[model samples]
Target: MKIIASTLLCLALAAPAHAAAIAQLKQFVSSTKTLSASFSQTVSSKGKQETASGVMELQRPGKLRWAYSKPFEQLIVGDGNTLWIYDKELAQITKRKQAGALGSSPAALLAGSNAIERDYLLREMGKQGDVEWLAASPKKADNTFESIKMGFSNNQLVEMELGDSFGNQTRIRFSDIKKNPALPAANFSFTPPKGVDLVSE
Candidate 1:
């Protein structure tokens, strides 16, 4: 699960750095209860880049599903209590308590409570093309990423870029976003398949 873990942890660590962009983020978070979107992600390091595509769904106060159907298959789910990471190719599943798995990270920004200001420091990055940008870093030390930036258009999250401690960068763009969608509870639940290895932490 190295690939999947690194991909998600790096992206999760990014936060807005600019204060001007907070308005869009605040409004979006305040109004949005559930969201679904198709996303494309790219990770670049030392002149090499890898790309992946996936679909994601999340409901506020903790619940999410990230389904990767690209070069390989992986599924990450948070059922508001436990977090599950399933790698289909390896037939392995990793599970952890949701509180320890997510905390106040970007996952919380999307699906957790609306207390972002307590965990992240937001700064103004002005605009990048058509998207208004915000940059963020955690108040507490996070070795995974040095900084993270988010792009918003018309108060909707459309892009995110993350830079890691090793100078690696990951960018994700969301398309066909549907806000406040009716996501069923089962979408966030997970169960290891028969004979699959399970690691509980």
Candidate 2:
């Protein structure tokens, strides 16, 4: 499973231009409940790049499903209390308690359970092309990612860049975003295939 992080500026720490960007982000999060988007993810590490394309569905209060279709087939689903990761090539399924899994993790941030002000030090990085960028780093020293930046276009989330502590950079660009979509309950449900190994932690 690939997790991504986020950022948003605070008015106190930002100049007038940045403060306006922060306000737009705040409105985006507050007004959005369920979102579905097609994403293309690129991971660059040690001078090599790997790319994957996927569709992601997110519901508030900790529910998400990410399915990768290109390069490999994999599925990651979170159903409020548990996170399930299934690797089709490996024929394995791994489950982890969501509470422990999400602590200071990118999943928490994406699920809207982690407050940006409480967990990250946010700043506006100004505009790039048509997108406005905001960067954030975890306030705690033990975070998995070194920094995360989010890009927005017209107050809509369009891209995210994540730099992990392991020197790997992952960038995800969102397209065909549908905000507050009526996602079915079955979208977040996962059942392991027969004869597959299940590892729970």
Candidate 3:
């Protein structure tokens, strides 16, 4: 789940050739029924950071599954409009409606029928320290995310940073990405156990 969230930040920070890359990615994701990729993430909370690595499987029209197979095994699945966040260690699952978090969700943007021009007003910015950057703010200012900043190296998305409504930030970097690959349909479906206590948030 964090991988997909991070990946969305990656998409948000489209490269200098972002228009072209997004154009290609749009065609790829829209046309393909399933796509898979490998990802690595670093999440920070209270000045401490934890690193997790995993693979992601996504189906268009709102089906996404993220498997954290390293450090620990965790699963987060979004079946169309419902989201399930499962913690293997605690043996707990948290559920939420997709629309509630759509404003700041990565799956919403990556899987939606939207274009760069429609959602965001693009800006060409100069370098921020050592990294070259491109900043994009949503045209719909009502969204929970304030802006998405994409960092590029040699025209590929090496890093992405996002600013959300609560002033919290999430940054993700991708490596050895395999785009538009085959994925299992089962990756997006969920069959929670009977007594897991489904909390409606």
User: Which tens-of-lDDT digit does each residue in 105-150 have in candidate 3?
Assistant: 4556665545555777656565655555667677776887786766
lDDT score of model 2?
Answer: 0.71
Provide the RMSD of all predictions against the true structure, rounded to 1 decimal: 4.0, 4.9, 4.3
The lDDT of each candidate is 0.75, 0.71, 0.61
Q: What ordering of candidates by TM-score runs from best to worst?
A: 1, 2, 3
76-137 per-residue lDDT for model 1 (tens digits): 99888999999999999999998887765567666777777877889878887877888878
User: What residue pairs clash in candidate 3, if any at all?
Assistant: 13-150
Looking at candidate 2, what is the lDDT of residue 60? 75
Clashes, model 3: 1
lDDT per residue as tens, model 2, 95-125: 9887666666555665655376788777888
Q: How do all models score by TM-score?
A: 0.89, 0.87, 0.73
